[model samples]
Target: MAQGTLEVVLINAKGLENTDFLNNMDPYVIVCYGSQKRKSSIASGQGSEPEWNETFTFDVNLGDLVSPLRFWTAIVVQRMTVLEKLCNIPLESVMEEGKVPAAPYNVVKDQEFRGQIKVSLSFTHKTHRHGHGMAVQEESYGGWKQSSTY
Candidate 1:
């Protein structure tokens, strides 16, 4: 099973408590790792990654989450970003091109001020061969769509 944690570190700023802005900001950086059979029968795409690690940072204004509540929201985003990246459907072109998904889980605020939010992400990949223990059919399109959980 994949395991990880998301954290949002809050900093001190002036007059910055906007829920809309906090929610709008992109948060979450996912890191995944797993091993799978080299051959795949299900059209879900490749099922093996010797190892993986990646980091995705948000472009939102850090000073916006000046309030305690907004700080918490930022933390949530940091965590969710990881899930999105891990389970995000592999681009057909990219996958076909032999580009493995990068596990992104390390994020740091670039701002030079105190009270800034810092998010730390980490996880392991636990993948399996397609239809290894069961039977599955490939789609006519030969590609898999995004799934919430695998």
Candidate 2:
């Protein structure tokens, strides 16, 4: 399992689909991880191009099979449905190298490229208890050796 604190920088998005016909769409973002969710403030009247420059944090306690996530959300008026993208992030890579620099990720809708949002990620690993399960051998008063963890 991966354990750490994750920091996300919600930068700016460009070339988004203008959902509003007459007025610019007041756009916002909802970021989700597992059962937890976080939302960014609406960029009022920003329409297709919006800048948030927001930061969000998530507690990471994922299983070994869990991979880092890159998330996107958009509405398809034609389909009246929401879509998502799932790709593993190199958690070890981020942990080893430090923060991921600001980069553009595709804003997709129904699998079509709508725009791109610039984001950065940083991971702070949670200090595991008992050396994350490393064995500590101790000799008992009875002279028996035992493996124990505190």
Candidate 3:
């Protein structure tokens, strides 16, 4: 098994079907990987075209080298009553291509197509190195330049 970090950038969504009857819907996203879950900020009246521009991170364990990730969106109507599900965005494509295409995902409500949400996904592996009795050289960049050897 290998451990890594899954990075999700919630860019925006468009053509979302508004669930609110009286006003424009305030939509937010719910991302899940295994038992972990994260949420994006509400778009707040953006309704059909909501822009999040937020980033979320999740620690993942790959068994048989597979990732389990999914995304969903919901609109807050009278204290979180309205719920809508976006499509399950795959992570394997991101792992192979560095970044997944920001494509529109089908949104569903009551097992019916409602709208679409666009998003991008990325994955990075954590590397471990053993440094024992080796000379350490460090360098600094930007603002001020510095170097040290030990």
- Score candidate 3 by lDDT: 0.72
Local distance difference test scores for all models? 0.24, 0.66, 0.72
- Candidate 3's displacement at residue 93, Å, is 1.8
Record all residue pairs in model 2 with backbone atoms less than 3 Å apart, i.e. clashing: none
Per-model root-mean-square deviation over C-alphas: 18.8, 8.6, 8.4
- List candidate 2 stretches off by more than 4 Å: 67-92, 129-150
The residue-by-residue lDDT of candidate 1 on 40-91, one tens digit each, is 1111111111111223322211121211112211213334422221122222
Q: Which candidate, 2 or 3, would have the higher TM-score against the true structure?
A: 3
Q: How many backbone clashes does candidate 3 have?
A: 0
Task: Using TM-score as the measure, name the better of candidate 1 and candidate 2.
Answer: 2
Report residue 2 deviation for candidate 2 (angstroms).
Answer: 4.2
What TM-score quantifies how close candidate 1 is to the native fold?
Answer: 0.17
Rank candidates, lDDT, best first. 3, 2, 1
TM-score of each: 0.17, 0.69, 0.77
Please report the candidate that would top lDDT against the real structure. 3
